[model samples]
Target chain A: MRILALPPEAPPMLRRLTSGLRRAALGAGALGVAAFAPQIARAATVHVTVAYYSAATGPYFKQMAAAFEKTHPGTTIKIDVVNWNNLQQVLQTDVSGGVPPDISIIGTRWLLSFVKDGIAEPLDSFMTPAFRNRFIPVFLKPGEIGGKVYGLPIAASARALFYNKTLLTKAGFPNGPKTWNDVIAAAKKIKAMGAYGFGLQGKEIETDVYWYYALWSYGGHLMGANGKVAFDSAAGVKALTLYKTMVDQGLTEPGVTNYTREDLQNLFKQGRLGMVITAPFLIGQIAKEAPKLAYGIVPVPTGTVQSTYAVTDSIVMFKASKVKKQAWQFLDFLFTKDNRVLFNKNEGFLPTTRAVAADPYFQDNKQLQVFVNLLPKAHFAPVIRGWENVAKAVIDAVQSVYLGKAQPAAALKTAATSADRALAQ
Target chain B: MTASARRAFAPRMLIAPSFVLALFIIAYPFFDIARMSVYHVSRFGILGGFAGLANFRRIFADPVFIATVWRTLVWTGAVVSGTILVSLPVSLVLNENFHGQGLARTLVMLPWSVSLTMSAIVWLWSFDANHGMINATLQSIGVLRQPVQWMARASTAFPIEILVGILVSVPFVVTIFLGGLSSIPSDIYEAARIDGAGRVQQFWRLTLPLLRPFISLAVVLNVIYVFNSFPIIWVMTQGGPAEGTQILVTYLYELAFRLGRPGEAAAVSLAMLAILMVFTTIYVRMQMRSAEP
Candidate 1:
């Protein structure tokens, strides 16, 4: 309660007014407490903030929440869905404002910062061995920092090359290009036939990830043992040079720097581009929007090593949560086999739970199986703080290279220096 | 107290409520940002130990910050001056007692009613390389053999953004100028004609001098608005294609949210606030001095 007392030296009318205001304040405060009493005394609400993966995300979570509420009558669930682009900003504001939700779905790359800031609650003690065994280890590893688990994998995905079969057949490599050289050769032939050979994504979110497919394929790594940026190595330059060459030779679509990952996918769906690399969610998008498109999946083209980028978004328990027990129970119920399978199927994400992986829906899907088989050779984002800053630097470098403003080696070197400075902060 | 002082105190007491509201609304955030700029803050704005001037030093050392400062100045100057030059002729024509003047005025101000972000998105689509109306129109007129990639590089993109800035800013300036025009009473042009002044001379001598205060007001307001404009750059190019189109406000956004360095972002913002304050002070003082007898 606020102290509304006036000083003893106040005049008669002022003191009278102050006392009257105090009485009014007391009356309103009493009414406020009365209004909130039932909320505090009855069912507890576990508020969850989730990222909108698709239109189905909100309704799917609401359905899960309702089912959980029915099973556990004493606890209520509240779900708030945010777009992926604004999730980080919203969470930061909510956390700093001291009203963070009980649970949130956050990018796995951000787990380190949350752990470092003591905002994430470690869920190891809350988990029994059976609960621990439910998750596939690879998917679970990203949410663990040091020796404790701070998040549970809610969704996981990996990237693969989605090649237009018709265009590839016309270019005489019908099964899709298996290597970078093959891609270039097929692209040249496709360009002669009045279509873009490769759909290069040179803009916006995941632009750096798109390039990392090439970098990892060519045996480059993100960070060294000392936790410094090492992407400026010889292999990194070579990988970038390969893309720059493609851009220069007109093998890619015109105005390559204007093409985001979504733009490239749109081109591929229109049959104007021969190949693009993207996640499995494109399969769902293609089915809904471009049903007549004939496309085949392949692993990211091979350089020195065949690799893909695996990523996950996880549900984390915040340290600020008051209803920890109820929140943990909700989390436990949400991760059940049926719930996992439903979420995976609705969002077109790869399975994160062991039981969901073995389900016939995922097991029988051939296009999904390609992504699953590539998982063993997938490279996750390195566990480091300030990874977004590094990605921004790399995205800038890649954009400049594609735009022909700077050479690949100089751009990578400049990016490495700036990224290291950002990482140092 | 003296009687005159007491008399002064009454009006001050009457204004106290609104004054306190303004203080709470404006000064609190100003003070908060100032404190954060001087302190060591975490990504989520948790203040750590006091680290004097380190945040300022970091931003000063950044090449992007320096480059963005100049770009912001260019953006402000171009947009503000462009708006004034465009609105002078527009408001002049609209002020004439011609038929359909109301409809013409409404058409000129239509873009103002649309939100800035919406206009930016429409322009983004308009300038799209593959399927934009601008390119189609140009190609149809036989202006080019190929469609131009307008947003691919900053060289073309920044100028287009400035044009859009000028377009959106014209309506408000024209409104101010129209108010100024009507206030001229229409008798001044008659008096100038009696003195043998030509039409251009009357505009130069009478119309411009009477419109001085309004021009100053428009410039000050637009400089502040255009300098802090976010969506025009953010929604269009996102200060991208290799940081080529970045301005201070957009760069500050990138710093605070994308890079998660709210402390340095606070420093950048405080720097921006100081710069605006200095500019407005100097400009207003100059205007006041030039207007003096």
Candidate 2:
């Protein structure tokens, strides 16, 4: 028989573990002091975290950081470039850890949450009339919430149809279909020719947006006047039903749920798809990858009203920053007319500033002009908490309908319920 | 100290350091999650006022969570059993001395060297509805008139995911089997053969009983790994074409990151830990009972 208890020798072993732990703690404390040493010596360090849009995004920010540092002595701009996929999670972690950057470029949709959390510094006090007027009014509207400006639009784009010119022309709509009915007619004709007709996106991020184009056209709003979800209403069902009908008729690409926006873009580039709706960046992609593909641009095909979705990414100063002044200076430097033009040109984003909009490079591009013209009739994603939840619910519902598992009305009702539950949380 | 007391406590003294390390590594997270599970945590990991059991109630109420729990079980069972079935034959063949044995072993372990994300990505491209190698090959071979959108629905996507899960798990399981095979003394088998035990009889009566411990280890470890597996399903389909292919872990990730509900996600994780604990306990109990005379 033996007792299961520590003997006299165990105390020394315990002392060893504690001593080792003390050494590790001392080492960590020394490293912490080393990390803070630079903070004490430097006059000010403005850390800016920007999302990577393209290969050019990092270098462009680094150049801006250098330029800003050169103009203002005793200040340093440290630009941290993060991938778009990880941007939100990184920001969430940073914000929670109480070490977020002085500034960040975030999706405008996320600005609502940032503002609610009191993490975003209100920009109203920093803006002069001249400085505010530098931006296009429509582009700036998305960054404003509850009568307070919290962010500045860093990049902007609106959606429109990119049609295969050869197919649409043979199908008797050379300039592309102008309405939902015309789209059906053109798609039917294209389907008769043994290729995909409409290129519908159903799998990933923008699956809900594809359906929303039709929803907005048919006079559906994401929320009711009372601020409850309204996309489950009649117009929304009609919009989804129309897409389902097209899928059933084989007028859109087969297995619509298998295709993402990128997949549809690929089909369009391969000249096997008649039409697809996407943002302005596809213009640059086409010029690079499929220069001879012969495509044309048009507004998203109308249902009862002409409508398209506009989206923007915003640069916001953090309320937690110790160096807000220096961060604002960097933002101002980056948003100058010439700098904006360079950024838009390099990243294929639409001009967010009035000065850059007048640039000849944008004005002369016929394909891009179509997207710019659609701005008057564009709808931005509504500023609401839990937008991702709404988006997931919508994506799931749309995919189910696209996969022919549920009827449009039934799926939309279920989604509205799920979305409401998420919003409540 | 007395010699008898020293013998018992010496082992405890040695284990104390590692026990403390395990507490830091595992127990801290378990405690943190347990706290979050009962609280109203914000999207960015901030704790609000206590909301006792709200997160767990929310998860239980969610239809997707219910479905994901069932699917996770299926994913673990199918992948683990399928892996054992495939690996047994492969490891048996590999156990025999043969020409190019090292090359065959290296080829079997080749996928293990590649990152799970990379392998999942390669599989994703291969199973793409169009312009994918599998679709192209199938079309060329006249086996399929049109390409199947393998990821468009759960029916095709989940099976393919299970198959990939099996493929990746095979190497690990086979290695375990080979180790077990090596441990069985040759003299025992020789004695059995001399006693007129045939190949089938010898294998059934000798090889299987000897391999019981390794098989149990493979089953337990693989269940935990595959149940929490994210990349293969996530990179391939992101639990989509709808949430049809969702398992609990993937759903937890979507909740924590995508939907910004870390509180609920913490609750889900605790539920997962509880399930694994219960399963392992029952499994070990059965194994121990069977081992008893």
Candidate 3:
């Protein structure tokens, strides 16, 4: 009851508090500026946050950035590498949050998904008639969604059979496998020599898709042109049977169910495997990780026709970009013959430009020549919206069959039903 | 104002910030997720009109989803029970003052210090079929003539994943139980020893009953964490060997993130949430009962 209000004489105290508050705010502001100085400086660069994948090709990317900035005065390219495995999710989050990169390089297979979601801007408006004619036809196919070109084809990775020359020599084959049958036969012999015949990834959808690439090359398309799930066809059955034959013949490891690119690479590096169907980029990894082993590359062996899986990286502009023209300019500069050659030659990827492909530098690089030769015969996976689901189903189906969880026919049937449903959506 | 009104006002004033924060952080997302569970929202934006309960219904009818739910239950059950069973004894042992007991406790908690993804990868490397340390060690010791493809076989993958889960989970249980063990008065153990109680009987009669709160806490936490664990299975096998290791969370991740089926993913998330809620309710009931005099 005796507690009296001191309001009449509180003005002095209030003034002191206000001054303290002002001083604190100023102090905080100063600290904030200091903390953000590097970011402010970083913002002035082109700031291309490329998903940081590996230390292997990082220097090359830096050189490309430096070269791009040098050619275009008053511009600097900043590459932000995201983890490769989380690249799609990171890009999606970036775009969804309205903080998308000016230009994002994404897998060709992902183009349709990004476009279908309407996050990716169609590049046709940016591409002049002259520039539109520059891309390889198939590389452009995967980047198109709903008859609109949504991305700029930067580079394509055509998968091929990379074999250990010493293993082949020890097996008395002297030369690497040529045809699918020859590969299978050579695999059997290689296994007899206490080495894995062929490193086939049979665990996940990604692993299974590699097998499907070979299957499709053997005249077994998963979905026929008529839109029926053709993976259950006679050709499909034949392809599965060939795989089963290989597994039974000790041509592949008994524990092929969980095999992955890393496992296959490890085996090849250790000289415990004869060959694996993988991308050209893995060759550089091998050269760095295990240089002692002599290796050879051939076009992916075919059964019915010559075909290898082609995955490309495309420069996709976000629909939310404030500067679309600048984004296009950056992409055009990156895709030019000179820059394209420099990027591809340094990155171990085959260039998307025909001129870059025909460049004497690529022709001279024996490793580059293998991918370049294969690109002509390469088949890009069907890139319709919901194709990711189809790919997953296909991968799962292959894993199911390999694990003996389901027969090839049964697995394919399940996959076909799921894929058809996904595609039909 | 009356004392009751003043008391009410005081509590309300105290809780106002928390209520507002919860409204912004938790309640908003909770309701949004509830809405998303039913509606078909694309990653870019809402594409279609209301699907009503179609997303939920689709999740139930889908075989892969059903399988994933079952696998999730199995994963949770295995990891939780296995973590409790393995950790209780380790905790009890460490409770006693023994030589290097502190070091042992630290070593047990070492796996917890590492991230789940890193632990899973290390385990994956160890569980490698060919040149893995486990296989090589086993073969060198003449125990296993040939290597076992731990992650390859459908039959073996679940157990291996559970093993990894248990590895990450046990330390938490051990740490919790250790706290409980320390809290229990030494007088109780002394009284039990005077009553001619052996180690097993002492544990069964006194230690366990008193540590019921800690046990329940550990179990409840393990169930929720294990149910939602994505990285271990995803990194090791990627829900493969034909999706044998495809738990609900991993499957939902693939559907939403990998396959771009946000609507279905949202549905799966709600279903998994409902499941965890039920489990939590049961746990709470058990805890309440054990807490009674």
Candidate 4:
């Protein structure tokens, strides 16, 4: 037995088994190294989280991410889509939990509070002069707070007077209203046609925004030069009076107090409403959902001034993000000519970049061009810290006037008082 | 270890994870909220230093908060009483020897299975001003000349909200009443009938007395649930039309999430907790008294 062991195998079967075992071990070692080799060679991917609202624009974001990742290898973009109504609460929760996204698209009005709270990182360092000059100057105003740029306007919107052409022609007004008086007169005629004339949104979310269209058109500002509540002025009363008169004259649906923006848009799409002051996005929705309904888009009918509410969604970098450089790179990639145009086209928002705005793709679109023309006359909502409370107060005041619970002046005064208190806080 | 000690240790070890989970989930949050009630927490959740009872004082001083508290009580009372009134008769029908008793029970339980948010959404569509089923039916039947916007005005919105609360709460309330009815011995009803008692008399003396515990449980639970209910009012109206439908819970939500004043929200929460605790204590006392032989 000792002699057989020293010779390594007494039988051919034993020798064959030993050779097979050695081969298997070598193969296993080679496979292990091969599996780990790529992991060792490639650097760890930098993940950047970007939060945005709008389910409609989610696909464009995904496309943007794919394009960005193709150009920048070893970097990934995580898109967090939140509902617009819950965006603030979700972002606040994320911030309190110490896990805010690397980048986010926030409401333009929220830029001030975010900066004050140190939630937004100043983009002055990341923004080059060329890049700074790329955005429309007026569109960038809200993003700048206290002499620092905390956000970059990614998407911009200006409210337009969208009219159901079929309803307008049936009401004997082939052309849509051109002035506030004409709108009121046309609304009465439309109401006589057994359909609601003007679809008014009076409830939460964009209630204040709807109010702003009339307020800005009537030459009212939310705050005066001294930073006191200014919506209680004469212009504010006129704005509120316009809405009350619409309701009183039976020009709007009886349930204007509860009508949401979508509710009004739906009525417009169904041809039950003659006119509505809404964003360009409603055009896309109407075209898709109610293709038979002929519609017209125009600059919102003027009061004292021919201005519309202009709101922008801006891309903001968070201070807590470890991938700030990568996030900035992705933002730059997103603002490219083709990407910006496609994104704005898909969203029905005006292009924020000057180059994209001047491009033939956006310039040639008549409906979009209407909004682009109105951009110079657009007025942004106040971007103060407590503007949400002010917005709430404005909504309440307008609802009170619409519901016949208070006079426009009294309601505006009460709203101003409440807003002043909120601002103080 | 001794056998008794080993047995106790084994059970404790088995329960340790769950006990820790409960402490983290319930006890920790409760204590943290209590602490926050007295401190000034900013919109960003930074502690703005000790504020003592300033938040509570501010809440108490606010007329809106006072009105919200009153409105919450009214909502809770209306919802709980309405639920009991509806569920009692439904449970009586359910307890009968019907052919499709099992099917009836399951069908009635469907509303409870549907999420509150989903129910609110469904109700919103049904109560829609222009194209809702309710409005269309009312108009077709000549009950309404013009469609009423159910969620627009405070007067209509409040009643509609209560009706919604009753609809959602009836399933669970009916189940509890059914359980109570089943547990009562048949012989007791027989004995009452033999003693010359009628159906109404039997219900009052025997059925109702036996169902006291279940009724108390239902009332207490419904009180808590309705008082703390948020999504229904939130989804339906968002406490709008000049904050007419603003209850304590919705007000607290606005304060915490919308207004970004967590400290005041905590105070509001603690105030709600105090009210609930009082009701719970009374419920516990009644339950203990009922348990006596």
Model number with the top DockQ: 1
Report the error of model 3 at residue A349, Å. Answer: 2.1
Native contact share for candidate 4: 0.69
RMSD of every candidate to native, in Å, equals 6.1, 7.3, 8.4, 10.2
Candidate 1, superposed: residue stretches over 4 Å from native: A1-39, B2-5
Ranking by DockQ: 1, 2, 4, 3
lDDT of 1 at A71: 90
What's model 4's interface RMSD, roughly to a tenth of an angstrom?
1.2
In Å, residue A128's CA in model 1 sits off its true spot by 0.7
Cα RMSD for predicted model 1: 6.1
Worst 10 residues of 1 chain B by lDDT: B40-49
lDDT of 2 by residue, B171-228 (tens): 9999999999999999998999899999889789999999999999999999999999
What docking tier does model 4 reach? medium
For model 2 the local lDDT of residue A244 reads 97
Instruction: For model 2, report DockQ.
Output: 0.65
lDDT of 3 by residue, B125-244 (tens): 998877689999999999999888888876887888898899899889999999999999999889989999998898899998989889888988888898999899988878876778
lDDT of 1 by residue, B99-119 (tens): 999999999999999999999
C-alpha positional error of residue B122 in candidate 2 after TM-score superposition, expressed in Å: 1.0
Backbone clash pairs for candidate 3 read: A46-A76, A49-A80, A51-A81, A51-A82, A52-A81, A52-A82, A205-A395
For candidate 2, lDDT tens digit of each residue in A314-364?
A: 999999888988888888888899999999998888998888989999999
Q: What is every candidate's C-alpha DockQ against the true complex, given to 2 decimals?
A: 0.74, 0.65, 0.60, 0.63
Cα error, residue A104 of model 2, in Å, equals: 1.0
What are the per-residue Cα lDDT tens digits for candidate 3 across A337-385? 8877766755678767778867888768887677777777766776666
- Per-residue lDDT tens digits of candidate 1, residues A161-194? 9999988998888999899998999999999999
TM-score of chain B of each: 0.97, 0.94, 0.95, 0.90
